[model samples]
Target: MDVVFSDVKGMKEEQEQQISLVAERNNVSKENKFHKDEQRKERMLELFLRTKESILEGWRQW
Candidate 1:
């Protein structure tokens, strides 16, 4: 009986640790995805601004 109880206790602790690790990994993945989305948006905006500037420069010569 004592050995059974000890085994149960150990299993509970291991499960808790695993849950914590999984939660941490999920948070990091979310952060990385968000960071990538922001970078893409910034790049798209920069490209749009550059295109506009080029068009305006051409207009100026007319």
Candidate 2:
């Protein structure tokens, strides 16, 4: 009986550790995704500004 109880305790601890690891991984993934999205937005904004400037310069020359 004691051996069985010890086995159960070990299994429970291992499961908890696995759950914690998964949670940490998920958080890291979310942060990475967010960072990528932010970078994409910044690039888009830069492109928009460059295009706008080009258009304005052409109009000024005309």
Candidate 3:
């Protein structure tokens, strides 16, 4: 649980940084790059969260 918690925290921090970078770049003339990157990151985060939930649920079942 602790490990999962720490991982989620780290991932959240990284996601924040990624989003912030995109936000900063938004002022400049960039096409779908930022949007694509954000979508990619979001999808990755969602997968990670789902995997984490599944693992936790499995642990609980044990």
lDDT (C-alpha, whole model) for all candidates: 0.99, 1.00, 0.91
Q: Which candidate is the best by lDDT?
A: 2
Alpha-carbon lDDT of model 1: 0.99
Q: Candidate 1, clashing residue pairs?
A: none
TM-score, model 2 to reference: 0.96
User: Candidate 1 vs candidate 3: which has greater TM-score?
Assistant: 1
Please give each candidate's TM-score. 0.89, 0.96, 0.51
Task: Compose the digit string of candidate 2's lDDT tens values, residues 1-62.
Answer: 99999999999999999999999999999999999999999999999999999999999999
Q: lDDT tens digits, residues 1-62, model 3?
A: 99999999999999999999988788553656778889999999999999999999999999
Angstrom error of the Cα, residue 58, model 3: value is 0.4
Tell me the TM-score of model 1: 0.89
Per-residue alpha-carbon lDDT of candidate 1 for residues 1-62, written as tens digits (9 for 90 to 100): 99999999999999999999999999999999999999999999999999999999999998
Q: Which candidate is the best by TM-score?
A: 2
Q: For model 2, where is the 10-residue window of minimal lDDT?
A: 1-10
Write the number of the candidate with greater TM-score, choosing between 2 and 3. 2
